[model samples]
Target chain A: MSNITSQRSAPFVVAQIRQDFPILKLKVNDKPLIYLDNAASSQMPQQVIQRLVDYQTNEHANINRGVHYLSETATLRFEEARGKVQRFINAAETREIIFTSGCTESINLVMHGYGRKFIQAGDEIILTVLEHHSNIVPWQMLAEEKGAIIRVVPINDAGELLIDEYQKLFNPRTKFVAISHVSNSLGTVNPIREMIKFAHGHKVPVLVDGAQAVPHMSVDVQDLDCDFYAFSGHKLGGPTGIGILYGKASLLEAMQPFKGGGDMIAVVSFAKTTYNHIPHKFEAGTPPIAAAIGLGAAIDYLLQIGMVAIAEHEHQLLEYATAQITKLAGVTIIGRAKNKVAVISFVVADIHPHDVGTLLNLDGIAVRTGHHCTQPLMHRLGLSATSRASFAMYNTFAEVDALVAGIVAVQQVFAGSM
Target chain B: MSNYKDLYQEVILDHNKKPRNYGQIEKATHQAAGHNPLCGDHLQIALELNQDLICAIGFSGESCAICKASASMMTVAVKNKTRADAEALIQEFLALAKGQLNAIDLIQIGRLAVFAGISQLPTRVKCAILPWHTLHAALNSGAETSTEAEHDPMRTTIGGA
Candidate 1:
């Protein structure tokens, strides 16, 4: 495996990696597809796709509480996938990894299972402004139901969180802290390890939303010492409708189940019922079997490539793209944080981002254009929406050139009309 | 997908760059704000009605070239026309933009003929029609049409009255 960080002299062979993804061969609007919408959903490689196909073909069975041949095999594979996820995130144990539908459901599970039980009236929950609506709305619902207060950590002009204000928000009433490991809209990589340390000192457990972070860089739940970490598999080149929520074993044992079903209960009767242990307690029903296995395959694929290499390549791409886009006459790049992922959001000479997205699509460059499920963040930045181009390990520098050319064409269309 | 040139024609861009009647009308008879939460396109339409005929009309907002140009052309097209005539023209223009109407006389549309290119870009039809919807809301005295319940094809309707 190539380590782009340590072996800085060697160039990342993006063309070789692009070959692994069959979708890269597709064309849209008579042009080669330049997928810059990885932040929205990354494309799956052949390995994960094949894994899903293999699961459906030979090993199709409902897992847990099965005695038949295929059923036992499916259960073993599902448990093996959980172990893979445990190793992927450096979790303490496989029992700490609970599979949910996606990042939204994972967060909602925490809110309902833990939050509804522990959080009390007038208790303060600390959150950051750059959170996706998924993270914010669930907590807001909790706060509303419990009569709890929610305090936000503001961001500077460059979209980095104000660490000084975040610490000040901590007090006796502070019960929890939920922050994103990376901003999906702005691409700011928040210092989670340090933030978690601060929250731990105040005895407040923190939940790191790692949906955007897990795909870009290596994430270790044990290293961060976060109480919980949530991420979606689809954003990491795995199948959709599957996600992982890594919680501390002690915390998972204490929290109530988010839902009740056949699998999550050890024993059920008319009057008395006992819940299952740790992970099984959280995952209620027959989960997305193929997607979990596919996510395991995705983890294997990512490990083979090495995350440090992906991060380094994506960083170079971001640098190259930022340099190129900054040179454009009317383009203004948003979120200039010192530490960022491979996402770039920008505006062009007061042009609406929708127009930019539409024009980019003509060149077969797919970029996201909207508030990006971060409405409050958009309001904080004084922007209604922005055109965002996010990169993955498979993206080439040539695709960045295509994006710039597409943007220039958009400007020319406006200028020539004048 | 539609060709980029057809959606962003020279006329549309020209109007976008230098939109006519693109300011607030002071002491207007009726005014309303419109927003497209889908794209965050927001516009405010103010109308000065002289009995049933529109005396003066102006708009202000931050939106796409299609929307701005459409608003600019709408104000010019509807000014001095009676409320009934303006409503009729708006229906024809929207139908033409949606590609439902094959052909319409340019004379009837006036300068609004530039919006015929909207038929090509289905996704952008909202940008072309948002201004007219805002105007409709303003003229009808708080009659707002919410698009939240509509199906996928009509999901991009202008939000708020």
Candidate 2:
């Protein structure tokens, strides 16, 4: 193993990694902040934050369609960030990267542009039960408008997708297959490469929602051979209000523009309007310039640290967390897939998830408690909500220990009263 | 991070553990359901009234500690109080939750005062207020005066005086 990988594998060194995130320096309720809610959004690194500050102070101007010095500088920085994203996801070309508000808007762009045009009446779009609302709702809207059929692939008790069932859902009418690369509610890391191949066999395009996956693992769109990949910047140590939608160049050119405004149009007249080319055709109006720059910095930071090392570190943390949390009484870990991300959701017996969350907060530990924007997934699991603790590279094994200790405290408090 | 440890006082924990009137009341006079979709906390509160006073209050649903305990304490606090008084108490609770009042007024509500700590958590404020919101809906739905049982609080009739 590499030195970083070896160092990460050691639990003690993992404990020390907590210092990297500046937010961990503060105290909550006189206790050190033990943030375990990385799946929702990650805390910004000093580097990422500084990048945003530098952009606002030094290079703040609208990108593209400009010739002045500041505009030229801003445009160069913006395109450089796009190039960074192109490398981060291993897309074939820089033109494949289109920036948007976040994962929701990214998915909506595809649904409205590509899905609206291709998905006709009686056409079918297949998705899994593990999708967040962002993935489910946009498709539902498109299906309803186009009179397309929506098919959901069910998950097993362990939260892993039933590949056989997913295949069964595939038909000649299956125009698209939308799936989350890693489930946000459960930590199940889907076999996306095989899934992409399966969809392509049916001649159907696939959109992989990588909001949870991109943060934890190395993603290569070329390797997966997915038609489109989407992820939120905020979930990956970058600023909010920025996300990327990577599509095949040909497919992007074929699709219509999702929104019509400045920057996305090449020419506008009362007589005729001509849309811009490729990526800019999809991005509308004053885009999140500073956020895009911050995302670039975040990508740089992750590349420097190496995603493979981060994945390995998270794997060790997941193993250790699973072992410790499962040992606690009345605590049932939600998902147990063979391959998964670092997100873990669980319910303490007879205790509502919010209660578990509040009690844990008393100890200065932050966790998400709810349906995790996947109500259908919760319904599939016969649960209303589950408390979730997702990990990032900056998280420490000591934070996991603190989580265990906090959960134990909840169990003790509720157990005595009951 | 504030010195709000008293918000999780033993009485609140006790009420949360062995919540009184914590089952569905058959043929309830007034029923209302409240939900905090953000956290997925759902609560259904049923009130049995005699004349203008609340005879009994029972609630059945699931939620977190702050919500469940608040509901449980609410049942005990509002029993036998006039509808107007109950409404006033709800308003007081809302103000306290918004940090407009001190912990002393919250302490007046006994164990329910433990939720004063939740006021510090902006996100969790909704979870603690689920029961109050449901009660408000139930009362406004003509459940206060009508002796007839209602099926779903979400669909309850309103504006009947």
Candidate 3:
């Protein structure tokens, strides 16, 4: 409520923005859709959709290898998309951006390419309790393989990381730190810049999982000085099967290539094979060209709307939703971190989150239920699961009201049954 | 909403609120665990078998209404039936839930027919059938404990049974 006036002044024209996403008009169970599962994946705007169609219809071809006209056009557009991503995150150079399948693959690439090469037995890698399985499992796999120990930074009940404990986790054997910029499960936005700076003080290279961060805020890789950053395209209003991993030039040069394929090598012979340069060295096969371009277009759309305005609008929505939901009896909101994005995870008294989700779906309100791929986090929080309503830029205040009503209806259904 | 009414029928709701045979069976001869990865539902089913017949059955776990209700009705449906008959009932129940077997098949299942509407909820079909699956595993393996694989319901093809 304090920042409500300023937030309203921000250039967030929700009605106009909602018109761009065709899927928002969809009806579910004979009711108007109120999609609040943005944390899972944001809906694509018509501009990005058209860009994808335009790419496929006219500019489609296998990039990097062909000398044909379509191939050249595709290659140029794909690389330009890389440059767009370069500026979107404000990375040092375009060469730092490596395209992969999604955030999961991006992390796996780092774990294999960098962790296998640099980390030694008995070395420690620091991670946090807020990590998604994509961030945790890859490191666990590497730790098991290399006999490395993983030190986890625990969280408070509010779901904020313990900075003091994080500082203590570092020692001479600590070679790497992998952390998320935001918690996808609880919407807790971590103090990534401070964490990255602290890790740097210990000479530990840090990898920031921006899958949940990039779509919500303006992130400058150079400003954070993170050694590596990764995010998924689908979560950023683009198509799936596309993601980017940004690593410093020095780090990329030192690490081995993740996947060996046709496009990854500069020269290949029966006797020997020479690998290609930085970005192409990681992008092994024919990449998702249309998705890459679509992501670039998505970036363009976000830029036009302005990240500051988007953040402000979503913050307002989060505040509004939190206040409204908090007023309801028997509803417990999880993860009350002071700094959070627009996600709200809550459990209704004596009701299973699965039932809540199913019942809410009947009201045409979509939410995510379950542990949200953060089983360890859920275990740490002493919750088996939660129903999460996450907001995006196009989501309206009225939609939040719809969600509250949906919850009330769900409660009625459960209460009456009892 | 009406479509959902078919899934969360009155019988299912009543059973969920006060599930039958809801506690552990300490002297059970067979036992198995069922897990729904999507919703984080955990159920452990134990059966006391006298010869080939299910003499006593109990389950203990935290699960959704669909799962709890399905387990409540399933224990009642298969109790005192021979292992072979129980297995047949399990198959028939799953077939009915997946819409493979029509409502006409419910005559054989008795009160368990309340779960026939489960065919409408493709996602919750797993919740309805998890107990039956656990029972099948317990009766077949003869092991002290059997566990289902962690399945992503979103990726699972409905009626794939």
TM-score of chain A of each: 0.97, 0.96, 0.97
lDDT of 1 by residue, B1-161 (tens): 56346647655556877899999887699887777776778888898998898999999988888888888888989999999988888788777777777555544785566567677666778778878777777888654432342522334442222
Which residue runs of candidate 2 sit more than 4 Å off their true CA positions? A1-20, B1-4, B24-27, B103-111, B142-161
Tens-place lDDT per residue, model 1, A275-392, is: 9998899888899999999999998888778788899899999999999999999999999999999999998986789888888888899999889999999999999989999999
**Which model, 1 or 3, shows the larger DockQ?**
1
- List runs of model 1 lying over 4 Å from the truth: A1-12, B1-4, B103-122, B143-161
Clash-forming residue pairs, model 1:
none
Indicate the worst ten consecutive residues by lDDT in candidate 1 chain B. B152-161
The DockQ scores of all candidates, in the order shown, are 0.58, 0.48, 0.57
Q: How high is the TM-score of chain A in model 3?
A: 0.97
What digit string (tens of lDDT, one per residue) describes model 3 on residues B1-161? 37456557574457878888999876788888877666777888899889898999998898888889888988888888899999888878878888788766455687676677778777778888878778887886533221235342222357332
What's each prediction's TM-score?
0.93, 0.91, 0.95
Give per-residue CA lDDT, model 2, range B96-124, as digits (tens). 77677875855446556666667677766
Off by over 4 Å in 3: A1-10, B25-27, B144-161
The residue-level lDDT of candidate 3 at B53 comes to 87
